[model samples]
Target: MEEILGILTQLGLTEYESKAYISLVSLINAKADEISKNSGVPRSKIYPVLENLEKKDLIKIKQGRPLEYHVIAPEISLKNYEENIIHNIHILQQKLTRIYEEKLPHVNTPIITVEGLDKILKKEYEIIKQTKKILYLRIGFILPSEIENIKKALNKLINNGIKIRILAVEECEIDGKVVSIRDIFEDMDVEIKYKQLPSAQLIIRDYKEMFLVFAENSGMSISNSNMVGLFNTYSVIISNYLSAFNKQWSKL
Candidate 1:
């Protein structure tokens, strides 16, 4: 059947080999001429196909007055093919991972700037998702609209074994309306401290990358009020930010 031949082809059998094997399975101990006739493969091609199948252990040959070909049991042939595919994939994985690691250091770090509340929030979420070890936040205040989304992203990082430290201004409140930082993250296992209300907003990940927001009342409203942020991965710049954060943290 065409469908059976297609499945065999997908399993790494040549079309002629699949046809010859199918024909031989139907006619046990079929000779080359009979297999070609039944399978519609050329007589000249059928011999080579049979030889290839024998080499793959997919068929057995009987040598008498004329050679005959018999199909291997489907269960045995299919299981062998599956095992070989898995083995090859395992080898490729190790080789490819090594190549990726060797090339990773030469890759350039990206610097991006995002504006508006929605875009900034989305970029922040992406950075948090990529954090492998630690997430550091210094906020002047929290916006009511963005709190839920921020909480979800930070919770996901925390669940993935990332440590989180949040430093907020002394009067840090949600939208300057209600709910303090302590109230929002009370149930979460993150370090929270109050500083002398920093004018800048920062989010650092792994001490390698950071996002700095500079806009008046940046985290208060969802309005597109020139709330600009710079995303950088330069190691020295991030290290300087880390140093400042540590100094601010110690004084709190």
Candidate 2:
């Protein structure tokens, strides 16, 4: 009984509606006073609530001196809910089209140069966490030990179903998930094609939003985020660079 009531609520039936319907189902063709008592709702509220249930098409009202309510079966009530969901989605589509037609671009470039050591790390960590597909990492100048947390983020991305490709300089050690990395590159799931650049560090998402971090030697970055600045929507250029990079690297 509780399970059925729970499912009814999950399907968007109000508390009063589910109780009112359930009470009518057991009593079968009940008037307001009887339904109010069985449903634990007060007499004054039962009639108006029943009106709502009828409007939802979950109940039928037969008028007499006092109106009697009948509960529609689950199959019929659920069909109403399914139709309601579709109708709501169609309405949302229309609303979205109107907003898109009216929306305008902002005047300023949406870029920020973050400062401070911990805040920098936190920001970079956050952005990496939000990545959905593709983390192209190439850290030739920095030793594996220097980029531990960043690599951890990369590993986390790969495990969470984000396709990853690492273009390591042939000499660099495999710092994270070597087997899964090989699995992705060997098949089309993640094509990791690398060319040896002297020292070009890059991390990108969807080949569209990219970050090119310069290897700053001899200074421990006080803030991780402060060290890196993002350049957005340069994927065409990045792709062309990756193409040239891959073409040269694949020669081996």
**Which is the leading candidate under lDDT?**
1
Stretches of model 1 off by over 4 angstroms after superposition: 1-110, 170-179, 218-224
lDDT (tens digit, per residue) of candidate 1 on 33-150:
9989999999879888999989888789988879967788868986887898899989997899678545634554787888888888788887787677899999876666778988
Count of clashing residue pairs in every prediction: 0, 5
Give the range of the ten consecutive residues with the poorest summed lDDT in model 1.
217-226
Across 1-252, the per-residue lDDT of candidate 2 in tens digits comes to: 888789878877788878888888898788899999999978888888899888888788998988878777858776876899799989997889457433412122345554444554565566566576666665443433336676677668767889776675544323221222233334344445544454435665655455555433333221122254444444455677578655665675
Q: In candidate 2, list every pair of residues with a backbone clash.
A: 116-223, 117-222, 117-223, 120-225, 121-225
**RMSD vs true structure, all candidates:** 7.7, 9.0
Residue 149 local lDDT, model 2: 76
| lDDT values, one for every candidate | 0.79, 0.62
